[model samples]
Target: MPRNPATTTRDALLAAAREEFAEHGIAGARVDRIAARAGVNKERIYGHFGNKEKLFDAVIKDALDEFAAVNTVLEDDPVAYVGEAFDRYREHPDLLRLLMWEALHHRSAALPDQSWRAERCGRKVRSLAARLGEEPSPDVGRAVLSLLGLAMMPLAMPQLAELLGAKMDTPESVAAMREHVMGFARAALEGRASASG
Candidate 1:
């Protein structure tokens, strides 16, 4: 079946809104700007999403869907999945910015998609624990968190990375850092030396 024009409009809105939220954050984002970027009337945003907060949530869901679509070799090698995840974040720094916005806006309140996000993360925690010959206990959970933090820290805190002299000014540096992340994860799991070795 042919794709509906409404779907096209919704996708355009999501793309436009992702950029808007990433740049301006929820408090700063404007509906008219999002609609203008999407090349649709602002009313469509209200019609399709009800409001700006809801639109921002939808953009996050769209990003989650995009990542889920890239579920490569996770079952075969969780370590390789870690490397792929690092690459994904490196390529989509805007997503990280959008997340920072979400964290800032919803610091105390529950996220709009809290339940769904928990369920999604729960699956990964379970998978990682099973791969390590254990249940999803606190230790395994912390390990999974470490893996994600290793991938995200550079993008999420580039100033810190720069201060630590881990700057990725070129492809070679990026590749080296990605390899270090994967190697560090593998080494941690295998009880071996650090990636620096």
Candidate 2:
């Protein structure tokens, strides 16, 4: 089946926007450049996304939604959850860069759709808590956040990882780090559960 031109254009715009935003951030991204890279007219950006800020929000929402869809916490094998997250970040490094750019640009201001994002985060924390045999609480939330941060660290900051003795560019090193993170997360969660019990 032939693809719809509008959908094709939208996808291209999004791809171009991801690269731009990942490299330059929201404030620095240019609609003209995005359009040129996407091979679509500049007006299509406004027609599709309303404006630059809205387009940025759409880009980030799509990236995060995709990430959330692919990664899940497993009750039986929690280590696999962390391993899968690390793999996801390895495969989609741009997402981390885009998120980092968003954080840098939105330093003091609240992010767009804060309530929706928070609700999604709450769900993940609850899921992680369930896997750890605990109810959702501040500790569970912190654990969830820590595990995710650990998974993303090597990809998000290759230079730092390298400086700290991790070979961020090597598949073997990444696999080893993934195993270590999974073991570390498992122990931490188990320790927390024991402490609470």
Candidate 3:
């Protein structure tokens, strides 16, 4: 029999899966545990998501979508958007960490049928191009990549960032770092802008 669609159980499962995959990575995550956390039967996970990899993919896509919704608001000013992007990432530290964990562990499981990652990059490229009144230069791509990298790499390598004297993970430190990096990024994006302006 088909389960009723009115319950919040699906939402619960996705949330639990996000936390689990964020912590455990693909190989470490277990459907039974996700189901248990969601208060659903283990079989229900299979019934709903079809498999573990799909569940993780859904979680990642959802996270990316949520991040984009917040960070991509100032389309006319991507340099300013970078600050907001940093703020969004700071508020949702786990999402970046989860992506990092997946990368570090080399979990190559296919992330569903969606490639929101590439789509997001493309959107950034277009946004950067629009801000510059022309196609974005190679530097723009590099800057956007660096902006994301700077935002994420610190958290991904806390000890290393700390070793380099860039303390991350603290609320205040992260905010300061975001401001500093955004300033640098804005300068790079608008290199010829009058300093007085």
Candidate 4:
């Protein structure tokens, strides 16, 4: 079937916007550059997304949706879940950059798709709870959030990871980081479970 031209253009614009936002963030990204990279007229961006901020929101939503789809929490092994999430982030470091940019741009204000993101987080907490054979509680939520933070730390602070003797670009270093993250998460969650029991 022939693809819709509108969809094709939207995809192109999103791809261009992702790169721009990751590199320069919302405040620094230029609409003209996004249009030029997308090979579309600048007006199309406003027409399709209303404005630059909206376009940035769309880009973030797309990136996060892709991440959620690929990195589901495992029911039996949280470590494996963290390992997979770490690998995905290693492959797509831009997602972390984009997230950092969003935090910088939005600050304390309500973020775009905040409710949807919260709902997704809730689902992850439930998944983690099921994995641990426990009810979804604040403890499980914290563990899930902590594990995600651990997975993101290396990419989010490449310089720090490197200064701390982590080779951010090599597979072996990433594997070692993953092992540490899994062990840390396992110990914390196990301790929490034992305390509660």
Alpha-carbon TM-score of each model against the true structure: 0.89, 0.90, 0.80, 0.91
**In candidate 4, what are the lDDT values of residues 152-195, reduced to their tens digit?**
88778889888888865766777778898878877877887798
Q: What is the lDDT of residue 20 in candidate 4?
A: 96
Residue runs of model 3 more than 4 Å from their true location after superposition = 1-7, 71-74, 104-111, 114-117, 136-139, 169-171, 192-197
- Over 40-146, each residue of candidate 3 has an lDDT whose tens digit, in order, gives 88887778778887787778778877887863543476556777776776778778867776566554665454465767677787776666665666766775677
- The collision pairs in model 2 are none
Q: Kindly give the stretch of ten consecutive residues in candidate 3 with the minimal lDDT sum.
A: 188-197
Instruction: Report the lDDT of model 3 for residue 173.
Output: 87
Clash pairs, candidate 3, are none
Score residue 30 of candidate 2 by CA lDDT.
94
Preferred candidate (TM-score higher): 2 or 4: 4
lDDT of 2 at 9: 93
What TM-score does structure 1 among the candidates reach?
0.89
Q: At residue 77, give the lDDT of candidate 4.
A: 76
Model 2 weakest lDDT span, ten residues long:
69-78
lDDT of each: 0.83, 0.84, 0.73, 0.86
User: Candidate 2: global Cα-lDDT?
Assistant: 0.84
- From the highest TM-score down, the ranking of the candidates is 4, 2, 1, 3
Candidate 1 differs from the real structure by a C-alpha RMSD in angstroms, to one decimal, of: 3.4
Model 3 scores what on Cα lDDT? 0.73
lDDT of 1 at 153: 80
